[model samples]
Target: MNRESGRYKGKRIIQGGRTQVRTVLYMAMMSAMQSNPIFKATYQRLLEAGKPKKVAIIACVRKMVVILNSMLRDGTMWDENMAKN
Candidate 1:
């Protein structure tokens, strides 16, 4: 991720992904905040570590995407506690 500093350093907008998938993942991340403990904890931890809000949210998004991909590859259901790593 590329960051720029104008007043505050901020990650640049992510480019070159399918808009449909991006929208779905973003909504999933939002829902995960309310329904998933692991995601919520990761997000809170990142914020407390001084990451920007958007950066923390995106970190959770990436985590969810990776976890989802792993589940699909393994043909297994997600275990809520499995994503801690």
Candidate 2:
């Protein structure tokens, strides 16, 4: 699950990738923070467990990518109950 790494130094979280893809993923993750209860709960749990806000957000985005990949690979639609695991 450790896909992308953002190196932190001073005030920077330096990461290398397509800027557009990163930006889009960030935006989608932000939206999921509000719209998806599972993602929201995971994010809150991460924060409650002492993960940094940015780190938690990135984790959720990674979750999104994994889940989406799974769905496409299995030729199935998203299933909330399935994801609860």
Top of the candidates by TM-score:
2
Q: Please give the distance, in angstroms, between residue 71's alpha carbon in candidate 1 and its true position after superposition.
A: 0.6
- Report RMSD (Å) for each prediction in the order shown: 3.2, 5.2
lDDT of 2 at 56: 94
What is the alpha-carbon RMSD of candidate 2 to the true structure? 5.2
What would the TM-score be for candidate 2 when compared with the true structure? 0.82
- Give lDDT tens digits, candidate 2, residues 1-85: 1344576335446478788998899899999999999999999999999999998999999999999999999999989987777
Worst 10 residues of 1 by lDDT: 1-10
TM-score to native of every candidate shown: 0.80, 0.82
lDDT of 2 at 77: 98
State the C-alpha lDDT per candidate.
0.88, 0.88
Candidate 2 — what's its lDDT?
Answer: 0.88
Per-residue lDDT of model 1, residues 1-85, tens digit only: 5676677787577888788988888888999888889999999999999998888988999999899899999999988767888
